[model samples]
Target: MFQDNLTDLLENVQNGALSITDAVSRLKTLPFEDLGYAKVDHHRSIRNGFPEVIYCEGKTTDQIRGIFLVLMRSENNILATRASSENFAGVRQIAPNAVYYQQARCIVVNPVKKNQDANHYIAVVTAGTSDIPVAEEAAVTAETFGNHVERIYDVGVAGLHRLLAQLDRLRKADVVIVVAGMEGALASVVGGLVEHPVLAVPTSVGYGASLHGIAALLTMLNSCASGISVVNIDNGFGAAYSASLIIKEIMNGCQE
Candidate 1:
């Protein structure tokens, strides 16, 4: 349960509306739930603002389904990343309401309406069309985390004017996620321009010289721009997660 839900339950018990035994029974799964192959972390939403996300890369269909089943009992919004279409199809059998994102290769199950708090916005930019998959991954991941996301695609530095045109939107974002491959110079350029934090995601979308994104990764890591931060090659999820934290900090104005 979330803090508000737990507080309400406690108050109900104190007022004699609920028996202590019943309350204790309800909260028996507060910490976690054992599912043989996995232990679903039900208390994540209580500790963090968001619920736990499933990473479907290395999991079998049955394993994913079992873990998802336990998490669904908690009744929080669910997100699973790096899920294949087949995985989503299996999950959909269990969660009919789940939606699969083809471009991002992610799945989302929303039993409750999402709280679209757009007071804060995150901008996701891509250097070229080839980098769109990673860019979409970052954009969708950020949106799943409850942040309004704006996407600016195919604005590589080769055409500096295209990127310049969106300077106003870039400046307005609470945090910016720049996704690029090849030389991966877009992050440095964006970092130099925007006052907000810039998350650099290098994808494996380049020629042999690119060394499967290692060259771009090194370039981004050595960026002279002060505000640019780098994630692993093609790790859009990591960049999005970091951007979410920055946006949340700016929105809540809390430091910890």
Candidate 2:
């Protein structure tokens, strides 16, 4: 909607159909819209390069639908994380185009399609097959935000050769998101191998001693590798967000 309004304003100016003051007046409300329960920030895409994303876990179905409607009015794409099938049903009532990713637990409305450069991509690596859910969340989030993503799964430190075999593939990524639960050693190993940024995500995929991923979280936080950064336990979305921002900056630099 923002882009459409800007285009209309420019066309109006060219045709002398509207004054500059009128265009400015129309744009003032483009920043935000208040809906009592929520104040949707329409200008977030302008300011942050990405629109606000809905966290559907705590919100009621009605609340999610309402928020999704307001955000869909914008030109930017809409993403709702941690959304259940029921939440998707509510959103689909208003947006028939919306799709639910069961494994990723995410709902995407009017997903943005970009011709991504192969050289500029995010690599999502997992320590075990059990970690793929969390890894998929990270991969989906990064891809939704217009970044090319490559998956390198089940390459834990148990068999160093598996990870070692993918050294060339891992190195090709501009940013690497390492997802693990047991001991969280994969992040450090990837960090040590790559020259690019490493964003580690710990999942609650371990056994009794793992303490619901706390042990892995602590392990990642204390990683000795130089450029290793960690997010909260099971926070694949957060890891992807940080990686997207890093990739965006790199893209901007290349364009300049």
Clashing pairs in 2: 1-75
For 1-256, candidate 2 gives per-residue lDDT tens digits of 5467667778997899988887666655563566777777776765677788888888899999999888887655588899999999999999999989898899999877877888999999999999998888898899889999999999999999999999998998999999999899999999999999999999999889999999999999999999988999998999999999999999999999
Candidate 2 all-Cα RMSD: 4.1
Query: 1-256 in candidate 1: lDDT tens per residue?
Result: 3556678889999999999888877765554666777778776754566678899999998999888888887655688888999999999999999988898988888744456556578899999999998888888788888788999999999999999999999999888999999999999999999898899999999999999998889989999999888999998988998888777777677344
lDDT for model 1 comes to 0.86
Q: Model 2's lDDT to the true fold?
A: 0.89
In the order shown, the candidates' Cα RMSDs to the true structure are 4.9, 4.1
Instruction: Give all TM-scores, in the order shown.
Output: 0.85, 0.88
Worst 10-residue lDDT window, candidate 2? 24-33
Winner by lDDT: 2
